[model samples]
Target: MRFSAGFSRAAAIAGLVGFGVLIWAAVISPARDWATSNKVALQTSRVEAARLDASIQRLEQEKAALGIETEFSDIWQARQIGEATAKVQAELGEIARAEGISLRSIAPLQSPDIPFAQAVAFRVEAEATLDRVVALTSAVEFHSPVLIIDRASLRRLTRPGRISPQPTLLMQLEIMAPVFIGEGEP
Candidate 1:
């Protein structure tokens, strides 16, 4: 009887040990591994998000440095092609006058086909000193609403048998500007 009772006690202890091992393998171990994997994934996501945020900030700073406007209000907008061309002419005349340029002719040229905007072009003939011409070109290039000096022809005027200081130049400039049509208009 003593031997049987000892054997029974040993069997019960072995059963409890087996049960503990089963619980640890089937439930606790898998749960712990799942938690670890989730933590790792969360950390990785945070790192990626931080990297994206930094990139966005860098791009925004670059945009600001380049003087790029976020709104389209600064762009030239007109309801008609004639209006756009007139505005371009007026602006060019003003700049030329300010730079002491004598405009011989200012004529509107046919615009090229552009998507979502109309290109307003002009053929401008002017007489000015070299310095004034350079200043005029610079002003047009840096003008708000954006102006492009597509083509420029400069000729130095010389008098026969007379040498004059600061020779005058004949400047023919082809300037272009993009004009956006207003909403609900063709």
Candidate 2:
């Protein structure tokens, strides 16, 4: 009976050990592994979220700093040629007044294709001496008219011996420039 009791006690301990190993394999180990995987996944998602948040913050900062109501790409096209021509005319008039040169003609050429945005050609003939003509040409380039002065040729016309209003110095000038746009499209 004593030997049997000892054997029974040993058997009970062995059974308990096996049951403990089964529990570790079936529940504890798998649960721990599952928890570890979830932690890694959560960490990855947090990092991604942080990156997205950083991008959004950068865009917001740019918007605030620049005070931009519209993106550059969204802006409409075409140029305002008439307003530019008028501006150029005013500037040319001022130049003529300052240089003591009377413009014979301020003809505007509206062509479909010209080097400038508006393709404007000004047939400006003036009754001025050679020196005044040179000064006027230089002044036109610098003034608000912003004429490119692509081509310029000065000719001394044959002045009749009698008093006539014909200009002794004739200037043919060509200018090409890009026009600006405003609230309205051209």
Q: Alpha-carbon error at 161 in model 2, in Å?
A: 5.7
Which one is best on lDDT? 1
lDDT of 2 at 37: 100
TM-score of 2: 0.45
Query: Could you give candidate 2's per-residue lDDT for residues 1-186 as a string of tens digits?
Result: 999999999999999999999999999999999999999999999999999999999999988967855333322123465766676666667778899987777777654364313344456667677778778878767654246677777887776575545446777776554454555553
How many clashes (backbone atoms < 3 Å, residues ≥3 apart in a chain or on different chains) does model 1 have?
0
Tens-digit lDDT track for model 1 on 1-186?
999999999999998899999999999999999999999999999999999999999999987866864454555778887888888899999999999887999998889666556789999998887888889999999999888899999999876886756778899999988888675642
The whole-model C-alpha lDDT of candidate 1 against the native structure comes to: 0.86
Go through the candidates in order and give the C-alpha RMSD of each one to the true structure: 8.7, 13.8
The CA root-mean-square deviation of candidate 2, after full C-alpha superposition on the true structure, stands at 13.8
